[model samples]
Target: MELKKVIILGTTQFSVMMCSILESEGYSVYAYSTYKEYLNSNFFMGCPVFLTEDLVELMGGVENFMILNTIGYSKLNTIRERTFADLKMREYDIMTFISQKANIYTDKIGQGCIVMPGCFIGNNIVLGESNVIYTNTVLTHDISIGAYNFIGANVVIGGNVTMDTNNFVGMNSVIKNRVSVGSYSIIGCGSNVIASIKSYSVYTGNPAVHKKNILDINSVNI
Candidate 1:
C-alpha cells in the first residue's frame, strides 16, 4: 500500500535519513518535533517541519495522515517508548518503511518499523513494531525480534534466534543460531553472541558475557 502524507516525530539526524527514504517512496513528508525551538527550521531535507504541540490547532484534520516515529534508541529507548505511546493514544496510523533495496523473504513485518537499505531479511522472520534495522544487516531464517529493538548497521544474526523487547543491539554484532536475548538488554558493538543473554543486562566481547544487571540501565552513563 502507498501512503501520501506522512509526518515524522523527531528532528534528529536519523529523522533526516528517514525523510529521504520516505521521499523516495513518493511520500509528502512533514516533520513534528517535541522541542519547540526546532520548529523554526524552515526545512528538514526539503520537508516542512512543525511542532507537535501546534499540530492539533493548525492542521484541520489528520484523517489521511500517518505518523512515522524518528526517535532513536538511547538511554534504553525510553524516549522512543514515550513517543510511540503518545502517538498511539491519539489513534494515529503509524507508518512502517522498508527500503526498496532490502530483500525481505517474508511478509511478517510489523507497523512503525524502519528497515534500511541493503538489509537481507530471510524467511519466516517475525519483526516486531517500532524496531529499527539499519543498513547492510543480515537476518537469517525463523528469527523473532520483539518490539522496540534497535539493531544497528552491518550486524549478522543467525537462524532461530529470539530477541525480547526493548533491546539495543549495537553495530557489527554477531549472534549465533538458537540464541535468545532477553528483554531490556544491550549488546555492545562488534560483540559475538554465542549463548543466550538474560534480561536487564549488558554484554560485550568476542563471546558475549554478562557485564551488569541493568534493570535501571539508564542511570549508568551511556
Candidate 2:
C-alpha cells in the first residue's frame, strides 16, 4: 500500500490520540483544526496544524494524503459526517485508522473507520463508513452496522445485529444480538439495548428504552 500522509481533522483529545498512533506506526501525519487559535500556532505535537480552510493549498493534491476525521460524534454523527463529506467533495480520500493492537478478523471494514486498540471485530462483520469503534469494544460475529455510527469504548455488541445509518452507541453499553438500531438514533452511555430501536430516537437506562425522538430534540453534546 502507498503510504499516504495522514491528516487528522479537529484539535480534540481524539485527534491527539490518533496523531500519536499514526506517528508510532511510522506514518507522516499533520493536523487540521477549525479553531481560530490554531491558525497562528503553526504546529501541533511536532507536526503542522493547518486552518481547515487552507487544506487545498498545503497538500497541493489529494492523492498523496489520507484524511482522518477525528472530530468524533458531535450531535451524534453530524460533525464526523460533515467533515467526511467535505473532504470527499474536495476529492480527498478518507483514511481508516486500525490500531496494530486490535484483532480484526473481518475482511470488510468500511472507509474512514477508526478501530481503536484492544477491540475485537469478529468474522463476517460489515462495518459501514466512518464508524468509530473505540478501545476495548467487542463486536460479535455477523453484526452489520451502517454509516457514521459511533460505537463507544467498552461496548459489547452481539451477533446478527443490523443497525441502520447514523447511530451513536455510548460507552460500556451492551447490545443484544439480532437487535436493530434505526437510523439517526443515539444510545446513551452505559445503557443496554435489549430490543430493536426506532428511527430518530434516543435510548438510555439499563434496559435502554426510548427516551424521546431525535426530531423533537434539538442538539446535545455526546
Candidate 3:
C-alpha cells in the first residue's frame, strides 16, 4: 500500500486525536499550529511542528501532503475551504480523515470525506464524496447519504434514512427512521425530521416543516 504524508492544521485536542489515528494508519504527519508556545510542548514533541502562519512557505516542495483540519465547530469548514483553494492553486490533492476510535460501519465512503471523533456509523451506511460527518454524529443502520452532504455535530440519523446529494443537516438534528431527505435540502439545528423532505426545501423545528423552498432563493427550479 502507498502511504501518504499528511499536514494537520490546528493543534487542539482534536488534532492530536486525529494524528494518533493517522500515525497508526502509517501516514507521516506534520503538525501545524497558530500558537508558537503550543508547538514547543511535550504534546507536540515527536512530530514536526510548524506555525499556521507559515503554511504556504513551509509547504514548499511538499506536493503529497494532505491537510486535515482538526478545529472544532464551524471553523472546520472555513479552514477546509481555504486550504482547498490554496492546495488547488498549487495543484495538490486534498485529503480528509476519519478517527480510528470512531465506530464507522460503512461499506464504502468516497474520497474527500471527513469523519470526526466520536462518530458512530452503523451497518451498511453508504456515504458519497466530500461528505463531512462532524463529532459525535450517529448514523443508524442502512443509511444512504449522497455527495457533498454536511452532517453537523451531535446529529442522529435513524435507520434506513436516505439523504440525496448536497444536503445540509444541522447540529443536534434527529432524522427519524426511513425518512428520505431530497437533494439540496437543508435541515435546521435542533430540528426533528419525521417525514420525507422535498428537494431544495428548508425544514426546521420539531417534526420539521418547510419554512420556504430553497428554489425561491435562487429562482432555479429543482
Candidate 4:
C-alpha cells in the first residue's frame, strides 16, 4: 500500500513537528510555505518546500494531497482560523491529525484538528474544526469544544465542561468540572477556572476572574 501525500502549510517550528509526526504516520510529507526564503532553501525538516503559487500544479491537483495548517496560538489564533477557512474555501481537503500516542475514547473529532501526543480525550467529547490540542492535555468525558480553540500543554479540562470557539486555554490550566468557558476568552497559564467565564474576557488567578474584554485590548501576548 502506498503512503498518503500531505502538504503541511507553514514554515514555523510547529510545521517541523507536524512533518516529523506525519512521516511517522506513513505520510509522504511535503511542506508549503508563503516564505520565499523557504523556496530558495528547497527543504524544511527533510521535506521539500513547495511555493504557494506552484502548489496546485506541483501536486498535480488539490486532490492529490491533504493540507494541515501548522499555525499555532499566535494572534489569539486568528491567523490559524483564517488559514483553515481559506483552505476550505479553496476546496482543499483538510487533515485532522491525532497523534498515535494520544488516547482517544471518542470518534467525534472534527476536521483540521491536531491532537498532539500524550493527550487524553475521554468519552462523549465533541472537538470542533481547526482546533489545536497541545501535548499532554486532558479533555474529560462529556465535554464540548468549539472551532479554532487553542488548548495548551498539560491543561486539564474536567468532565462536562463547555468551551467555545477561538478561546485560548493556557498551559497547566485547570478548568473545573461543569464550567463553561466563553468564546474568545483567554485563560491564563496555571490558572484554576472554578466558575463560568464570560465571552471575550481575559481570565487569570487561582479562581479565574475576568481581567478585561479581548476586544478592548490592542493586542494579546498569549
The best candidate by TM-score is 4
- lDDT (Cα, tens digit) per residue for candidate 2, span 81-148: 88788778877777888998999999899988999989999999999889999999999899998899
lDDT of 4 by residue, 62-167 (tens): 8788888898877678878888887787787788999999999999999999999899999999999999999999998999999999999999999999988988
Give the per-residue lDDT digits (tens) of candidate 1, residues 139-182. 99999998889999999999999998888898999999999999
Pairs clashing within candidate 3:
none
Candidates in order, TM-scores: namely 0.89, 0.90, 0.66, 0.91
Q: What residue pairs clash in candidate 4, if any at all?
A: none
114-135 per-residue lDDT for model 3 (tens digits): 8877899999999876678988
Candidate 2 vs. true structure, TM-score: 0.90
lDDT value for model 3: 0.73
Better structure of 3 and 4 per lDDT: 4
The TM-score-based order of candidates, best leading, equals: 4, 2, 1, 3
Residue 163, candidate 1: alpha-carbon lDDT: 95
Model 4 vs. true fold: TM = 0.91
